[model samples]
Target: MRNAMWMQGVEWLAAAASDPQACKREWERGAGTVLLEAGRHWDVVSVPRQLGLLALDILWYDPLRTPGPTLVDSAAHRVGFFVPPDPAGNWAGADIRRASKGSWVAVPPPYRSAGSVEWIVPPDGSGTLHPPLTLELALRQANKTLAVLAPVSAD
Candidate 1:
């Protein structure tokens, strides 16, 4: 049941990647060194570029089926890959403690950044790129989309 929901998330992520305009703004805001977009089930940590590898598992997704799938509501659980401000760290803020907490499911910190990455086409959520898309660029896109979901985001 959870995997089914995750598959839906992958579809939504791919649709978002398909939109240059939406993804562009999202890219710039995330300060992502790279942005990779694929189907919704993708996790940034899985990327070769992601610091420790910020893998996000889509616990749930609600789609509307237009311009491709989009996430109406979703849940994700995150695993720590890197520590922030460490350059090698993919984390957003502060440090990981013995007892970390969040409003959503467990994962890495969502950040507000000011750089951008672009994708030529959408991948199906393999966390790897295809055709015009590249792995380096995909990481940047992931950060942007993840940023959009930040608790204080305008997106």
Candidate 2:
């Protein structure tokens, strides 16, 4: 039963793919990850690994503030947080990249977390996503924290 529930959640996420059936087949064939288009079901905000970890920590510290599905790409040294589609695409940051509308993102199976790209937080099958405003605040706080922790350069 638990496995079924997990698969359901994964299916919900796979539905975002251009061809949901093909995506699932890839997973069944043992593919580590598959590329999915953004802006249809959700948008992705990718940040540097360090900043993403800090932001994730901030968001997860409060149980009620838990974020939506997030992915970590070790090879790219980046992390992606899923948020609802924003037609206006109003997102900005020094090292942040927003994958919306015409963009693609690599997504791992919800159960896999030991690969170049893996899930830090997997979807729960309820179609829940991070609130854009809340994520923005967390990112801002994380950036400020990083600024404070950065080593000062000697003249």
lDDT of each: 0.29, 0.85
Residue-level lDDT of model 2, residues 20-125, one tens digit each, is: 8988888878758888899999999999999998998889877765678898999999989999997344468788999988998888778776478888888878
Please give, for residues 57-141, the per-residue lDDT of candidate 1 as tens digits: 2211214211211111111222222111112333233222111121111221022212222221222233332211222233455
List candidate 2 stretches off by more than 4 Å: 87-90
Q: Residue 9: error of model 2 in Å? A: 2.0
Clashing pairs in 2: none
Q: Which candidate is the best by lDDT?
A: 2
**Candidate 2, residue 143: lDDT:** 92
- The true-versus-predicted C-alpha distance at residue 34 of model 1, in Å, is 30
| Residue 137's lDDT in candidate 1 | 38
Clashes of each: 22, 0
* TM-score (C-alpha) between model 2 and the true structure: 0.92
